[model samples]
Target: MRRNVIGSVEQMTGLQVVEVNIDVTDLQLPEDDEQHPLHDGTRRVR
Candidate 1:
């Protein structure tokens, strides 16, 4: 994933990428999705 992302950025922008950083803040399970109701093209951040 990191390699692909870097390669895509370099290819599109013609800039050399030095590094990539990733931070995972939240994880949603299948059960969670089922429990929560879907919104109509709206998003909530907490």
Candidate 2:
């Protein structure tokens, strides 16, 4: 689901997806209200 959403965003915005990190170890996903490190668009994947 996440990949689909990301792919759609990339297609719509034409932003290159340089990295895709799937932290399966993080079994406890963050709550919607909580902040995620990757959620911040500060890191330039390229």
Candidate 3:
């Protein structure tokens, strides 16, 4: 994935890529959309 991203960027912009940084912060499951309050017109309680 990193290689693909870097290659695509370099090809599109014609710029050399020195490095790539990736950070994964969150993932949403298929069921999450149904259970998440915001999706169903309810505010999330803080």
lDDT of 1 by residue, 11-43 (tens): 999999999996667666656765666733445
Backbone clash pairs in model 2 (N, Cα, C under 3 Å; residues 3+ apart or in different chains), count? 0
lDDT against the true structure, per candidate, is 0.77, 0.62, 0.79
lDDT of 3 by residue, 1-46 (tens): 7899899999999999999997756555677878876586554453
The C-alpha stretches of model 1 lying farther than 4 A from their native spots are 25-46
The model with the greater lDDT, 1 or 2, is 1
lDDT of 3 at 18: 99
Question: Which 10 consecutive positions of candidate 3 have the poorest summed lDDT?
Answer: 37-46
lDDT of 2 at 30: 46
Which residue pairs show collisions in model 3? none
> Residue 19 CA error for candidate 1 (Å)?
0.9
Looking at model 1, report the run of 10 residues with the lowest lDDT sum: 34-43
Model 3, which residues run further than 4 Å from truth?
A: 26-46
Clash tally, candidates in order: 0, 0, 0
Best by TM-score: 3
lDDT of 3 at 2: 86
